[model samples]
Target: MSDNLKVVENATCTFCGCVCDDMNLTVDVDEHRITKAENACILGKAWFREHGIEQRPFALIDGHEATTEAGVEEAAQILARARFPMIYGLSDTTCEAQRVAVGLADMLGGTIDTTTSVCHGPSGIAFQGVGESTASLGELKNRADMIVFWGGNPAEAHPRLFSRYAVTPKGMYIPNGRKDRTIVLVDVRRTASTPAADIFVQVKPRSDFEVLWALRALVKGRKVDPSIERRTGVSLAVLEDLVARMKRCNYGAFLFGMGLTMNRGRHFNSAALLALATDLNQFTHWVAKPVRGHGNVTGADNVVSWQTGFPFGVNFSRGYPRFNPGEFTTVDVLARGDADAALIIASDPASNFPKPAIEHLKRIPVIVLDPKATLTSRLARVAFTTATYGINVTGTVYRMDDVALTLRPAFPSPYPSDEQVLTAIRDRVRVLLGGNRLPAGAAPIAPAVAAAS
Candidate 1:
């Protein structure tokens, strides 16, 4: 390795929600690529390697190449002129950027939502309904004798979850690591993580809430109907045995994912899981955590909560923060044709969102800020390819367990950070709005003055 090459130690990998912060990355400054990444999983390696790629133009305005300033100006004009606008996709960016997005939405008196609305929004709702008993990953690794993975497959999605957190890692209380812990996996079918499970409970599809409710009944000493086995696909004897061990375990942890949040029951399923964890606390120490998807979606939720007083699906059109899922959420907002323009950052909703939402994006003026050209960018009237966070920009991100971690960049980036661009646009909008503050601590926008006009 040449002296010109820079090595970043203890660098964080912002690929999955795991947020593994033990990577040692070697970046070739001249080539602007990561040459080597030690202690990184496949996903983390890919995330770092892709940071050096800049195949797309720096910025684009209606399919034409433009400077960064021109792109910001156009984005500001679009938001300032719109009656209703939305700012979405903060899951992949830093908390600093997410804060600016919230401020931008307040200024526009528009709606703002994170990708969490699609993934873990139900979990957030459930937490509000029935408060959960939760702990950090370190607690599970150290003190948990029984580790449960429900509706989530950590093997494929979070590659290092087991090795770094629960099953394989050695800790103070679990000195023998895997030998000291009993891993349980509950899903509709066997997954890659099933092979490592000491117990596998296969339930019927969309029956997770039922199974959880049954377990809660069992924990509460209520006699559950024997027919629950037929409905859930898990035998009665299996349920009884599982509940017995759960009560006997020194410390148990239930880690659930989208299976519980996205299915028919939605927030009710998550509520049942959390309720079960709380119920088990009477017999033994227990905790539950939602398996977050993206690297910084948890951070997005946190920043939005602290800044806007809500998690996701927040609306400011009333000049005050109001949250109502399924109504104020991104998908519903777009599907209802409530938003005339959108400012999307670090997310590709056009490809990932439902068909109706994508159709709406096609008709509206869309602004996208991302490092890569995504399907959403193709439809964007103004798209600016920005730097990848955690690799090229330094900021704070929250782990799935709500642990805050500061991210350091391994290499400098040519593109401006999302915070810089959003701040510039906000400043420009401030000027365009005649420099008066709005009701929601936002700069006033001169009505009827169109940016594209």
Candidate 2:
């Protein structure tokens, strides 16, 4: 043990959607890195240990080093002069920064989208069609006796989810912890999570909607063909047993992942699953939630929905916020060459987007704000290195369960926070667009931005 080591207790890990906040990080102040992370999972330990101050410029303009102020000025000018600019990527950032971003979109009258458009966008659409029956992680921990994981492997993706919250933890009602719960895994094939489940239901690929539909029918006491087992790759006996367990449980929860949302049926698949959860309420308490990927992505959806009326793929070009997925989504807009400029925050779209979308992003004048140099930042005309939230900066982040937690920064960064940088850009854009005045009947910016702060 070094005499100069600093221990930060109860630090939060934003590596995944779990948002585990009970880590005790041992920081080497002289080395400017975390030496140890107590009470952290493998992923959380790696996340805390790998994050440190990088030797990169504070800002870059056209790949050249420049002052942060110059980068903000150029970014504002590029956004102001563009015909149809777009803002994307708020999933990894804080809620305060997300709100300012929505205000910036309104000020520029541009389209604003989030990573949700790709990951759980279909789930959001399904939520709108068939409202969600969700509960907090605490509720599931304490009361849920039957837990189902549909189309997601929390073992590899969210390492701490089972041991910390769902499976192995001792809760108020679940005193025996893992012994008190019945874990069911529903996926197309066997995964690491399969070994953890008491029952693993392997369905045919792309047959999630059919399986969910059959389950709903069985729950409703309606006649489902026994041949459904051949269609969905699950035996009728197995389906009946699963439904019996679900109906007889004290509390049951369905936590689905992109497997259901990004499949062939997409939103329809999610809708059917949610509708099944709704149907299960007739016999027992049941809830469903999307297992989000990013730590603050749920916060992004919440903030965007609060500021604009929509969750993602929002267009403000008509002097009001409009909700349309394919038309206004980042990938669609960029692939169609509709946007002339873009502002990306805390996301790397160039590496993951479609070829056409990546090509269009390269052609446009792009601005990025991220803690590290990412593929999107490399292609940006103006890139500002911002502080990492939940580590070097403090703000509000939402868990996958929509529980809001305040961030406690373990260390400081030389770079500015995303909220500070976005606020500066917003102020500059407002000045450029004539002193906070917006088009007739548009949402007011001052009030919304202030409320977010």
Candidate 3:
């Protein structure tokens, strides 16, 4: 890669829901680096800052350095012999990689779950209860005259969301960006992004579901006493105004965040939003999109759903994919100490998992495959550092809207890409299975490189 020869490939930022596209890259082929980026949000810049890697590949065996091949073999042996195994963490890689991972898990009669099971499992449950109406980012950008930010701050969590697509930016039909869109903020506390909104609705913590339901009732043209106002902290008049605006808009969009899903109501909150969006469609067009946190969390859902006819929290212990969010989720399985071993790829669970799960991890052996020194890596029995996906390798990742996009590398490195590492693991797993029935296979997975190369 040279500065003069740097090519910026058109793609979406995989970091968050506002998948901003049209990013520019200045790669120096001669220098083997990404020198600059254009049109990416602040978080996107941080995502690309550690472009190429310099760390040599090695593994930890019994808390000691060893070859990655030895580690993989040891991991394979443990997983193969264990009565129950869990394969988790698929929220930061390509859909292709996620597919291969789930296939191996199914063949081994293990559980395959994603971070969503812990972060947005409730939302998924709610989705199953009441289906949602959704629109493409392009549609929202072009036609949505009213946009609401509920329980999220895109400026920090999804840095370039407003400037790239949702609130502030101009689109094909939106000649004037900020002026054309009406912005509303709903949160428990005020943040940097909320202050800039045209309307800010402050609600009590963990009362998102109650507040939303009340608003939905108001949207349906129902009258309520002041007690409803006392409960939601928003006057009935204010709720009526939001309903009126939503009904008047040609197209209305709601960009929801983890706050709704993580609070007391959990999945019901998601159900309410979906139901509310559906309700709004009775008079005017309305839709909602989850403000996802991980780069490939959406990809995990897409891959699993397409492969095994189910989404996250899929169990394969019975040699067939079974969907059960509450039982098969990573937290539930680990908390019960059902998993004897684990193979975590592309995420850091040690920092995010609950106390019980972390305690269990300390007692069990873990195999970690990632590009950085994360909390998960620190505790793993075997850790292998591979090439960074967007910088040293290229692959396909799905956007928040289920739009698949290609991520191209701008620099070169000695480390093999994620594809190579994944293919290696699959081959090793195949050898361990020896013609076992696999459920996640979509293609004849060839080895990308020698397992320990």
Deviation from native of the Cα of residue 213 in model 1, angstroms: 0.6
- Flag regions of model 3 displaced more than 4 Å: 1-5, 437-453
Give me candidate 3's TM-score against the actual structure: 0.92
lDDT of 3 by residue, 357-390 (tens): 9889888888888888788888888787777766
Go through the candidates in order and give the C-alpha RMSD of each one to the true structure.
5.7, 3.8, 6.5
Q: Write the per-residue lDDT of candidate 2 for residues 1-453, one digit (tens) a residue.
A: 356789899888888899998989998876668899999888888888878888889899999999899999999999988778999999988999999999999888888999999999999999999998999999888988999999999999998889888888878999999999999999998998999999999999999999999999999999889999889899889999999999999999998999998899999999999999999999999999999998899999999998888999998886888899999999999999999999999999999999999999999999999998999999999999998898888899999998999988878888999999999999999889986435546555544646746
Model 2's C-alpha root-mean-square deviation from the true structure amounts to: 3.8
Which segments of model 1 are wrong by more than 4 Å?
Answer: 1-3, 435-437, 440-453
Predictions ranked by lDDT, top down?
2, 1, 3
TM-score of each: 0.95, 0.95, 0.92
Better of 1 and 3 by TM-score: 1
lDDT of 1 by residue, 13-94 (tens): 9999999999999988878888888988888888888788577787899999999999999998999998888899999999
Candidate 2 clashing pairs?
A: none
